[model samples]
Target: MFIIPAVDIKNGKCVQLVQGIPGTEQVVIENPEIVAKDWENKGASILHVINLDGAFGNKSKNLEVVEKILDTVSIPVQLGGGIRTVQDAMDLLDIGVEKVILGTMAVENPETVEELSNKYGSNRILVALDSKDSKVVIKGWMEKTEKNASELGVSLQKKGAGGILFTNVDVEGMMSGFDMDPLLELLNAVDIPVIYSGGVTSLMDIENLSKTKTFGVVIGSALYKGKIDFIDALKYQKIL
Candidate 1:
């Protein structure tokens, strides 16, 4: 499985949020460009970049930082948060993001995802299904939806989403280890590539997740907290 390092940007700084809460954020690095370059040098295949400001409704707040990271890293960056329109996705793609991850838009405006997939091809479009108790959440995990994650996974795939980033919001940034049952269920429900996120605390968690058919796993708080060493974890995954 691919080991992707997450660089979540809030207020133009690289931060990690606990359970998607704003004030619960912990700044990991002052310069996101430096962090992106370091991760690239350490053998990260792809970097996961999220804009917390965008997720909270302030969409344009982090574009400058996002641009810096893109300019600094040679590796692909899969960006998420606040990408609500096809024009928004296109603008990012035009600026060199390898993939754009859609969560709220995927749930609220699947037609936009379809339009993007058709224009850019599905490989460049990823739909994020953030959930709690297997029900998908949107608007940065602040709003709960009646949609089941597994069902949504299949629906997004049908809409031409190249892949699914399945994040369990309950465990996100908790450093508490993952709940495998729900992850496994979502994996089983989707035929396309599925990237697992949330609650990865140790190399053991990666080892266990590797047993599943996930395309990749996003490591956030665990990496920032030193619970898991990025380079070492990549080596353990045989990704380096």
Candidate 2:
């Protein structure tokens, strides 16, 4: 499985949010391109970039920063946040994003998922199912929906999504380890690649995740805080 490092951009700086919260964001790196290149140099095959501003409803602020990161790294980058419209997805891809991750858009307008997948090929589209207590959350994880995550994974797969980025919000950024029950449910529910996010604490977490059928895992706080070494974790996952 791929060990993807997360580069969450907020206010034009690389930061990580606690449980995806706004005020709790801590800037880990002053320059996103530097962090992106460092990860690529350290053996990251893909980088997961998130626009915290866009996610919170200010979509236009981070495009320039994202552009610099893309220009700085040769490795593939999958971006999420504020990608609510087909135009938004296309604009990112047009600039160089390897894949566009849709969250609220998937829940609010699944037809756009189908349209983008058809136009860009399924490989270029990913649907993020961010959930709390197994029910899907959207609009920056502030609103909860009745839809179950596993069910949403299946639905997105049927709609031609290339993969699912399943994040369990309850343990996210806690450095406590992953919640495997809900993750496994989503894994079983979909045939497409499922990349897990949220609480990842140590190499043991990656080891446990590797035993499953997940496509990959996105590590943010753990990696930034040095609880887990990126290269060591990659070696354990046998990705490097």
Q: Best by lDDT, which number?
A: 2
Could you give me the TM-score of model 2 versus the true structure?
A: 0.98
Q: What is the C-alpha lDDT of each candidate?
A: 0.90, 0.91
lDDT string, candidate 1, 1-240, tens digits: 899999999988999988999899765579988998999999999999999899999999989999999889999999998898888999999999999999898899888888999999999999999989778999878789998889888888999999999998989988888789888888888888889999999999998888888889999989888999987787656442
Model 2 spans > 4 angstroms off? 238-240
Report residue 29 deviation for candidate 2 (angstroms).
2.0
Candidate whose TM-score is highest = 2
Error of 1 at 209 (Å): 0.8
Clash pairs for candidate 2: none
- The TM-score between candidate 1 and the true structure equals 0.97
Q: What's each prediction's TM-score?
A: 0.97, 0.98
lDDT of 2 by residue, 40-79 (tens): 9998999999999999999998899999999999999999
